[model samples]
Target: MSFEKTWYSLNEAIEKFGLEKGLILKWIEDGLVRAEEIDGKVERVNVDDLDLKVQEMTGI
Candidate 1:
């Protein structure tokens, strides 16, 4: 099992780390990751989940 601790805004994560926001949004749509939402918008990505996705994508 994995545990999450930190968080990052979608744009910040994507822009700074070269993550694809559209794919992330699609993952959110598919219920693979959890998004913190406000005003019907996703405000941030759970960093641990992002880390897992990154590791999976990069085979790290």
Candidate 2:
């Protein structure tokens, strides 16, 4: 609910989630969040799923 973007890059998610980049990558590896390849190697985060996970984790 605090985020405004519909999509986020790995780096952006790191900043928004206030977590380390490695942690975000770990989430991707752990299937906590899904990443979509936008162009070549670049990826976009599914903000909706990320938001839901945040809410679940924070009990918001």
Candidate 3:
């Protein structure tokens, strides 16, 4: 069996990728990725969108 994550909380993304919160927020604001607000507090980002953004930024 294999498990893969399709969405990640903002905090999780920051911690897991060592990325800045402001940058992620900016990405959200710029409509670069899709995000959903959970419990009106936590926000989750789409893993596929984030990966694409990272690849674009890193030129990888």
- The candidate maximizing lDDT is 3
| TM-score of every candidate | 0.77, 0.64, 0.79
Highest TM-score model number = 3
Candidates' C-alpha lDDT: 0.81, 0.75, 0.83
lDDT of 3 by residue, 6-44 (tens): 789888888877788888888888999789976865479
**Compared with the true structure, what per-residue lDDT tens digits does model 1 show for residues 30-54?**
8877789999899998777777888
Q: What is the total number of backbone clashes in candidate 3?
A: 0
Writing each residue's lDDT as its tens digit, candidate 2 over 1-60 gives 565668898778777877677766677778987888656453888777777877888999
Distance from true location, Cα of 49 in model 2, Å: 1.2
- TM-score pick, better of 2 and 3: 3
Residue 23, candidate 1: Cα error in Å is 0.9
Name every residue pair that clashes in candidate 2. Answer: none
TM-score of 1: 0.77
| Candidate 3 TM-score, true structure as reference | 0.79
